[model samples]
Target: MTCRLPAALALLILPALPAGAQSLEDSAARLAELLRAGRAVISENQALINDPGLGDKGLTPEAFLSQVTAAFLARTGSPAVSEDLPPFQRALAEAQLEAMGQTIAEAQPLINMEGVGFKGFIPAVFARLANERFGELADGRAAVKITAPPELVRNRKARPDDWERAVIEDRFLSAGWTRGEAYAEETGPGFRMLIPEYYSESCLACHGSPAGETDVTGFPKEGKAAGDLGGAISITLRP
Candidate 1:
């Protein structure tokens, strides 16, 4: 599920912007580049896992997460996140962990599913990028999204908040999306994207079941669709 941080909540947590800082659009562009890079890395890892000969050693999912997590740490040059994730993503990540754990431990078993998943980790990667770019970590419902006219995915938009909304609409008038710095601002510069089933399938294991639907701590329970793309991560900007 896509995590969304409302604009109002961001101001309460994000640090003040620096003088002569980049406009929210510029900062968001740079952040999107980082997010794309991270996504590429995750995609590459998934490809490696599915490679024909890589499984000769019989690697376990735990081993895969260990190696991949280590590579992520080494690549980013950040401290380990053993005790807990940075404050901004703690609640979000923890909830994900619980849901994922429950899926891996029970749901999958009852349903006879196999193969550990990966794409679902975008939120974590987004958090990492937000931390590096903004010097602040956003937690559950806190995140950033890149947006633009579909024709101008390359041409940056001055309306940063609009782009955040674009992500939820999944109608980036532009070519594609990138990542952005997670922050806060007056009127809450950015907006949040609601997660619906359309964006992911793993989300169903825990979120689809009636018992898990309304009770998931960090997720929304109503007006969501089977394939509905969730809300965007809102961030306040200097511009």
Candidate 2:
């Protein structure tokens, strides 16, 4: 039931609703409720992934993904997308996202902002997920090597059958958001989901600035000017 929604989105959701679709206050309230449930979906699964007891009990990744995803499906009332996933892969993604969440949470102490908005975390979270799941993060030069097809990254306005930009703008650079068979394309063959993090002042310190005043643990400094990247997350799926 742990849904990871960017705080900025909470503000954006209201205006975007269909014209005269429903009462704004009521619609916002409902969205908030559903989002709360979605967040719980992530949180609960993360706990399961981390529980040594579950692992010790011979709970395999497949077994866990099935159990946890079922829980999420039930809570959010979303279609059971996990059935399309190999149980092992599903569990791996769940665990990876959990770990990424932890990394962002840890960075909280270093942050000096009102709240860590979600838009900024896309790259870091994607980096963390790639490292945990794919091994060796792919953000800078490495990402260019694993480039997303031009069709996918370009055409910012087109909403294809599969794949969507993490944000409309190019500034929030999380390469993992657009690359990978699992996330970038949907040929009815694999997994896909955009797990965006809320922006934190700490994130702005790096992504926001062209010349980051401070250096992340692994990345070196470049330039300054990028400013608070506090905005979006969109994912694609296959039926």
- Which candidate achieves the best TM-score against the true structure? 1
Angstrom error of the Cα, residue 98, model 1: value is 5.6
Stretches > 4 Å off in candidate 2: 1-127, 130-167, 170-198, 208-214, 218-227
All candidates: CA RMSD (Å)? 13.5, 15.8
Q: TM-scores of the models, in the given order?
A: 0.32, 0.26
In model 1, the runs with Cα more than 4 Å from the true position are 1-41, 46-61, 80-89, 92-140, 143-239
Q: Please list the C-alpha lDDT of all candidates, in the order they appear.
A: 0.36, 0.33
lDDT of 1 at 13: 57
lDDT of 2 at 46: 42
Task: Return the lDDT, model 2, position 181.
Answer: 18
- The top-ranked prediction according to lDDT is 1
